[model samples]
Target: MIRKTLALLLLGLFAAPLWAADCSTTIEGNDAMQFNQKTIQVPKACKQFTVTLTHTGKLPKASMGHNWVLGTAADEPGIIADGMKAGADQNYVKPGDTRVITHSKLVGSGESDTVTVPVAKLKAGENYAYFCTFPGHAALMKGTLTLAP
Candidate 1:
């Protein structure tokens, strides 16, 4: 009975991390210029969080490229504008944008990328926004993100 109880305890211990994995999330982009999710929550308990962006469409990057960019909602417009100026070679992001908290590399259809954001930089009450910086894609590819209690 003791051995069985210990085995169960060990199993529970191993399963704890899986249950606590609210730190990572996946977002999908399609040819239609849409993101699968409109909102994302990052758990405060995590020291860092990861966002994986996947392009499910079949279009090539040049015609329909996508990238995940994170910043405060207020900073989005300026960032997007600057990103546009930076153009495609820079993944539609300014080369040294301090406003960008984290961003993934530009990706094409059937491709994916991940960006890691440090939790310490996130404020609980601030409104955070995430979007694809592919030229004019921001209008249809934006989403909100928040820090969870």
Candidate 2:
């Protein structure tokens, strides 16, 4: 019984890291108006999560700017519409938009920005989406984020 318990403890120790959650990720946006990742799974163990957006292409913000925007999939249209009105100075996100859960600043080629999302705000079964608000870029620069069970 002592030997069995010791072996089980060793196994548990080795497996602990696997069960631990990763609380951050990096995503890339390019000149072609594309995002490198299509889906992000936020681990439930995280109290908060950080997403880093890197603009990987060679273009200026005026023409190929990219920013990370997060909201419910149902709220996407309204957010985008308001963001456009908010204009570039606001990083293409409306000021104080309640629909926006979190967002990163607009970035150009070789630039990057990060956004922190409170895990408490995410619902496991709800559809959450992330996208770029650069004019007309949403058609391609978009992805889904979900809270892990």
Best by lDDT: 2
* Positional deviation of residue 50's Cα in model 2 after best superposition, in angstroms: 0.7
Candidate 1 lDDT, 92-119, residue by residue in tens: 9999899999999999999999889999
Instruction: State the lDDT of candidate 2 residue by residue for 16-70, as single tens digits.
Output: 9898899999999998899999999999999999999999999989999999999
What stretches of model 2 exceed 4 Å from their correct place? 1-16
What are the runs in model 1 whose C-alpha is more than 4 Å off? 1-4, 7-11, 14-19
lDDT of each: 0.95, 0.95
C-alpha TM-scores of all predictions: 0.92, 0.90
Please give the range of 10 consecutive residues that has the lowest summed lDDT in model 1.
Answer: 16-25
